[model samples]
Target: MFTHRIDSATYLKLLEVQDSEKLFQLIDSSREHLRNWLPWVDKNTTVEDSRQFIQHTLDQFAAGNGFNAGIWYQGALAGVIGFHKIDWQNSTTSIGYWLGEDYTGNGIMQKAVSKCLDYAFLELRLNRVEIRSAIGNVRSRRIPEKLGFTLEGTIRQAEKLVYGYVNHNVYGMLLEEWEAKENSSTYDDETYE
Candidate 1:
């Protein structure tokens, strides 16, 4: 996987042990914010927990299933974004992302996801990309919408969160849709950069 850089910010590679401490600190500090939507936070109580997650991600990438990347904004470890899994037979993948509370509203995630879409369609040659956001998570769902993904449908009670089952709005974009967006007269050149 290549470092997806946008202007001065770089989405750095996440690896086992290498970034476990910083990753754990960010998770610990933002436990309240992240745990609200993410179910894995409570399980990530120690640096060893993060190392385990990183190791899984590393093995996932090595197996060509997918990979995760740390969003490095300016000079700090801000958050993470990556493909959840690559369904090669279907030529499809699902994207998941989260930014540290402090990094939200800075257009960092929007750019990071756009670049991920480009890599999925252009580099990986995947036909379809999906982003499923828990219903009412307006901020998290907006990235796919802003990128022109079609509102596929809602997967009611799709996820069993810590609280209860949460509905998910599934957003999808095909390679054709992405290409059309790329060739549109009003296309923003910076989007896929």
Candidate 2:
């Protein structure tokens, strides 16, 4: 039960084999919404597929790499947030996330991402955090931008969606910058704790 509360009404729980069914349900229901930007959506056709994903994440966690954690909103599985990879030598990591259509517009991801950034910097001692969203994805891109990340530039055709390839807008935040933001009172660690 890898659980971390983001706030009074939200949390992130590690998805495991037992969670495959519920995870599948969420993905199945959000297929159309996710398929637009996520190419792997169609590949997740069954509970077993989700189980494998959970197992992989668990392995990643055990290896001290990074993890894919499920977002819970109001006690329900809402979506996922994960570090795609953690480059230990470089002390850097990249993150990705999504929320169900029904759970959007509640600032759920903003808070969730803040906590993850805190963990990356404080616990993992990562030097930088990167977030990349498909071009034109205003909602996804806004998360990093609002959090004070610098837009590094666009990677043309960085990801392949079901429909076609899409450009990605990359944003990056350094540990020093995060500390500066913390010192400036833009984000209070106590509030997240």
Top lDDT prediction, candidate number: 2
Q: What is the lDDT of residue 181 in candidate 1?
A: 84
- Model 2: residue 74 alpha-carbon error in angstroms: 1.0
Query: How accurate locally is residue 2 in candidate 1, as Cα lDDT from 0 to 100?
Result: 48
Residue 101 alpha-carbon offset, candidate 2, angstroms: 1.3
Candidate 2: global Cα-lDDT? Answer: 0.87
What lDDT does the true structure give each of the candidates? 0.85, 0.87
Q: Candidate 2 residues 1-193, lDDT tens each? A: 5678988888988888888998999999999988898888999999999999999999998888899999998889999998988999999999999888778777888888988898899878899999999987888987898789999999999988877889999999999998888766354433221
Give the clashing residue pairs of candidate 2, or none: none
Best by TM-score: 2
Q: Per-residue lDDT for 71 in model 2?
A: 96
The sequence of per-residue lDDT tens digits that candidate 1 reaches over residues 38-86 is 9898999999999999889999988999889888988888899889999
Q: Please give the range of 10 consecutive residues that has the lowest summed lDDT in model 2.
A: 184-193
Query: Relative to the unseen true structure, what is the C-alpha lDDT of residue 40 in candidate 1, on a scale of 0 to 100?
Result: 90
**Candidate 1 ranges beyond 4 A from true positions:** 183-193
Q: Which portions of model 2 miss their true places by more than 4 Å? A: 183-193
Return the TM-score for each candidate structure.
Answer: 0.92, 0.93
